[model samples]
Every structure is written in C-alpha cells, then in structure tokens.
Target: MKRIWNNSWLQKGLRNSTFMQSKSPHQIDPELSDKLFSIVNDILPPDKQVKPRTGLLTFGDAPFHISQPNQHDTKAEFEHEYQIVTEAMAGLRKLVPLFLTREDADQQRTLDLLRLEFDAKMQQGAPETPIDVAIDLVRSVVADVGGLRASVRIFIDLFRALSERRDELEQQRDKFWNLPHRAPEYYARAIANRLAKLYARKTGQKPTSGASTDTGDASTKFTKALEQIFSLLDIQSGARPPADWAIKNLTEEDLAPRMSVLENLGLGPSPSRKGLSMSRCVLPEGPKD
Candidate 1:
C-alpha cells in the first residue's frame, strides 16, 4: 500500500521535521511567555480566560492546541497570538477605569488586577501618586462619562488643586516638591494643557482655568500672560475674534494661559465646589458653523 503525502500522519511527520530543523531559532521563552500570559489573563474575564475543555491551557480565542493539524508553524503562531493578546492587554489597561466604575463582578475583577499591576510598577521606582494617579483618575472618569469638554474641565480642576497645594507647600519645598513623586506633576500639567487645547478645538472655546482664589499679583500676571497668548493666536491666524464669540462669567484673570486659545468662550466657577465648574459657551444663533 502506498502512503499518501497529504495524510495526517505524513503531514505531522513533515511538520515535525521542519520544526526540528529550526527549533532553536525562534522559540518563545517559557518565562517570558508566562509573564505575558499573566498580564493577558487578567484582562479577560475568568470564564473567557480559559475554556472548559482546554482547562487553563487556552487564553481567550488563542488555543494552545499545538498538535492540531494545519498548525504547522507552532512557534511563530504562538508568538503572533501572544502579540495579539498583549495588544488586547494594552486596550484593557486603558479601559480599566471604566470597568472599575461598572457594577459587574467580572469588571471589578479586572479592575483589581489592573490596580495590582499599577501598584507593582510603582514599587519599581515609578512615582505613582497625586499628579500621576489623580490626573489619570480625573481624565479616565470624566472622559468616560462627560466627553471632551467635561474631561477638560475636570483636568483643570485637578491641575488647579495640585498647583494650589504645591504653592502652599512651597515654603516646605525641601520636603515636598523636591521628592521624585512631584516629577510626574510637571508631565501631568503638560498633558492637562494639551487636553485644554483639545477642548478648545472641540468647542471653539477657551476652558475655564479653575484657578483657586486667584485675586493677587499672581493672578494679574496669569491674566496678562493669557491675554498675550490669546492675542498672539488671533494675530497668527489672521482672523479677528469671532463677532459673536463670547465666554460667560470668565475674564482673562479667570483663565489659564494654556487654555486661552479661545477668548470668546464663557465659563463660570463650579457651583458644587468640586470637579470643574463651567457654563456652556454662548454661540450666536444658527449653529457655530
């Protein structure tokens, strides 16, 4: 009897031969694979992480059925699948805050896992408090619920609080701002400013600065700087300020320089004394086209 080359046994033999020829070239390390699995495993729900029939060997849609027919390139396929898992993990990381706000058990589980991972990373020399954590919390929470405008407002509120606190502690700077944790605040401030710009682009309005009790020399300087920046933007665009553009309850003193991109938008202090307090911009009749 002649053996068929396309038979299962023959195909397995060919795959085995090919794999043996290059077994050491691109093998996935067991330790690294386990580490990647640990991260991926937490991103998915318990039931979805492992199939009943596969026990704990399967992860999401990627099965560890190494001996299955047509899965000839086992190592490459494994790595590719793991790469996809890592990408999913990255997305899940961003979505963790949303999940934490959810009431589902599966979501809470994923949130706890993410918090643990964040804590572990922090322990490894990363400053993970106040500026980093606080701003991120505001961003994820506000952006999830209130859209770009709300997110911008919440960021300004948080940034202003941090700035005020930092200013108060300036006399004790040797013990506070000098710490490594404060380093992240600088980056977070820059990110908040960028978010302010995004809000301006989305609404064609300057964001409320959320400056806490600014009625001093600092306030004057801030307002002047803000007006200068807004003037520059208007001049550079070669367009006059919108004829009908106007911000409510907000003067240059109440605006942040970074958020002065739109001088016509209106904003007011928060009524609730927490979060961002902002009033909607008043555009002239007939859509802001």
Candidate 2:
C-alpha cells in the first residue's frame, strides 16, 4: 500500500513539471490551483512537497515564457514565483482521481499505466500534459469497461484527437500571421524618408562649383564687394566675416560657390542701399484756456 502511494506521487511529480512550465501564473486558475494546493499539501508529507527550483517548472523561471530565470529584482518576487510552483503542484493533484479508481492496482501497475499512456501520446505528437492525459483517462474509462484494456485504447484515441487539434490550430495561426500589413505603416515610413532627405540637404556641405580659381584675385574682389556695401550703409565693420560664423579653411574657389548659395538664400551683401530717414518727433500743444 505504501509502495502504491509513492508510485502515484512520482507520476504526479513528472506531470507537475510539464504542466506548470507551459502555463503562466495568470493562467493558474486562482480558485482551482488554490483548492488543489490545499488538498495536495494536506495529503503529502513535508519532504514530498515538490518545489522545482531551476528551469524545471513555470513559476521559478520567467512568469510567461520558457526561458531560465537568471535573476530576480527582489526576494518577494523570488518567493512569489516559487509560490506559483506550489500552486501548480496542487493543480496537478486534481487530475489523479480521473485515472486511479480501484484500490487493486499496486505501485508497478500504476507506474506502467502512466508511462505507457505518456509514450503513446508522444508517439502521436501530442504535447506531454498530465491534465490532458488525466482527462483522456476519464474518456477512456467511459468508452470501454473499466480496466487495463480500456486505459490503453483510451490513450491511443486521445493521442490522435490531440494531434488533429494541434494541426488545425497551427493552420489557423499561420493564416493569421501571413495576412497583409496596413497601408498607413508603409506611408509613415515613406514620409520619414522624405523628412530625413530634407534635413540632410539643409545641413550637408555643398561642393564648390569650379575646380580652380586665382585665390588672391577672388579674395580681393569679395573684400571690395563687402567693403563697398558697408561704406554705402556708412557702417564701419570688420574686414573679414567671423571665423566662427563661416568655413575658416575655405579655398577662394570654394568660397565663391558658397557665397552664391548664401546669395540665393537672400543672405548675400545687400545691394548698396542708402539709410532710410527716421520719423521726426512733433511736440504736443498745451490747452488754450
């Protein structure tokens, strides 16, 4: 009797890891997992309470993924994840009754039955889910007379049903993923490219038009033009533009094209213009009375 109980415990442990790992803490039905945990915790001995630490179960690892948990931000988070593991174990215990009905099947018999059913499901490409297997066992019991034969037949049928359902879901998932994207996404990308081009044009250095020029002559001409405009406005200014304001290392040939670009942008030396007249001030008259 003791041996049979241990075998049942092993079966539950094996199922616990597989089932809990696939499900997230949110999926752990609050009422169901809590109820299950209460029952299993009461039934099992303290040492027998399986707390899978590493990547073996869902809770200790990432909450909603299959990856390993490298670190936890706080001790509370770490404790919470393990708590989920305990809850999952309870959830798994809820399925045992669907299979083990009679008191006759001893340890070896029960183990063999579960192992065979698990292998049968794997052979048919159904995922190893203990809850699913237990559900299948219930159906198998109903289909045939309750015994070993019925268990075997039920497992085979269960595997086939799971495989068909998995295939159908995969087809639907593929269809949804392959659908065309929205038009606005493409339009947004195009607008972004155009804006980038405008920014580049505004900031990029424009190449000088001609390759060579007499630097001394061009410099003399530009200085004359600059001073002529200054004199016409009667404003005394520095002979050269500030180094910080424009290209300091510009060759005379390069300066000409850049100056032309500035001129086109309405920044070139303004046409030599006479200063405009200021408005004359008028005095207000006091009241005659």
Candidate 3:
C-alpha cells in the first residue's frame, strides 16, 4: 500500500528534489519530455494511457498552442495522477501470483492461500469474496478514468488474450493438478475419511475393521476404500450399485451422454467413443469382492 503524505510533507519533498532547484521554470526540454511521454503512453494499456486532446485553438485542422491550467488546478491534477500510479502499483503487487511461472513456490503458496480464502468466504456465505471485491475495484478504477466503454474494452481484450493462450493455460492447469496433494487418489482418500467420520456420527458405529492398504496399487486401494464407504452407507439399490452390477448394466452408450455434458461444461476432456468403457474410463478396476 502507498503511504499518504500531507501537503506540507509533499511540499518539503519537492523542495529537496532537483525539480525545485532548477533556475528556469521550464528547465526540461519540451520535445524530449513529449517523446518520453509518448513512449510511456505507448507502453501503457489503453485504459491507463493519457489521451491526446485538442489545444485551445486550431488552424487548418492542426492544433495551435495548448492552454495551461492555474497553479492550484495543476497541483490537484498532479496529486490525482500520483494517486492513480500508487493504486495501480498496489493492485499489480496483489496480482503478482497470476504473473509468476508455474514452478515458482511463491506462486503455488499464493494460489493455495487464495483458494483457502475463497473457500472460507463461501463457507461463511459471503455475498462477495476478496477476489470479487478486488476485481470490482479494478473495474471501477478503469471506468472512473475512461468510463464504462474502457472497462468493457479491457475485459474484451482480456478474453481475447485468454482465448489465444487456452492451450498454454490448460497445460499449466494440468501441471497444477499433477501436484502430489492434487492426485486423484489423494482426493479419494480424503473423501473416504470424511465419509467415514460422517457415518460414525450418524450410525454411532465404528468404521470397518481393515482400512485400505497404501502399499498396493493406488487405483486398487481407492476402489477398496470406495467400496467400504458404499457398504457403510448401505447403498445397494438405484443408479449407484455395486461394481459388478455397474459393469454389467452401464455401457459406453449409457455414459456417453453424461460424458458429453461434462465436455460441454469444460469439466472433462472431449468424450471419445472408441476407447470408452465402464472399467477403463468410468470406473476403477479391481477385485469384485
């Protein structure tokens, strides 16, 4: 966050700076200043850049000498510009995680923290999370400077950039998912443990005797754990049945539509009919008993 300075402190700082020491009021070369301004303007986003305006007068469609504001107005304008710069810097700092490389530990930690914060907000039934608030603040800042049209243009540009980088973004997402804690088996084990606790609370009975072994194949262990959970819940009928019944009754034809729905929602990969099967694609294969 930027520190707020009183008018006296700002005046003191200016007095100490070279800007105040210059003998001539216009010590800086106007052409050089204009060139530097143009360079910086070109580098800045459209929403942040200063727009050129017509001078006080024009001759043959060309701008004449530009008019300068009063000293008080110029001071206020400079303070406003300084405030905008500081706020933009603060916002960029908060968004550092988004720009970091996938392998950066800081990026991972920041993302985990954000996810936890988002989950906490959701659990607390918050109307707006911190992320949402930050986004709205940025939109408001852009709109304040360049109006609603600029905000829309900024979002449209962002969407285009994301669309162009979809494949790279997917690869980064896949990398994140491949992390140890994000493994499928890890989630399955977590779900099983939670369900076991819930079952104990509901039935007032201890969980099954033999817990799923960690040494065996992960898929086998996951399957066994799921079986134990289903047994505990006594779900012996309806759409969710035992593995044997599922293998016999459910086919690619039956699951294809659901897979298509997932694909459409961008939750799963594109559904492939050729390699689709109950055991391979839909369910974990293990001993039936």
Q: What is the C-alpha lDDT profile of model 1 across 129-204, one tens digit per residue?
A: 3533333343344434534334334433443444333333342343233455433223223223333333344434
- Model 3, global lDDT: 0.35
Residue lDDT tens for model 3, 1-289: 2232357875465456533233444233445345434533442345544333433211111011111111223435545644554444344323422422234567667755765554443333322224233333443354345443343334334433333234333333353333543333322233344333333333344333233257532233223444544333343322112222323433333333233422332223433543222122221111134
Query: How far off is residue 67 in model 3, in Å?
Result: 16
What is the Cα-based lDDT of residue 171 in candidate 1? 25
Top-scoring candidate (lDDT):
3
For model 1, what is the alpha-carbon lDDT of residue 187?
A: 24
Per-residue accuracy of model 2 over 1-289 as CA lDDT, tens digit each? 1111246675576667545436554344444334433433332346434222343233332111111112344446545654554344333223322343233447547756866666554434322335355434443344334344354334434433343333333333343333453222222222222222222233343211111154422143223332333333233443233211223333344323223221232222322331111111111121244
Clashing pairs in 2: none
Work out how many backbone clashes candidate 1 has: 6
Poorest 10 consecutive residues by lDDT, candidate 3: 58-67
lDDT of 1: 0.34
Quality of model 2 by C-alpha lDDT: 0.34
- Residue 271 of candidate 1: its Cα lDDT? 26
Candidate 3 local lDDT, residue 275: 26
Better of 1 and 2 by TM-score: 2
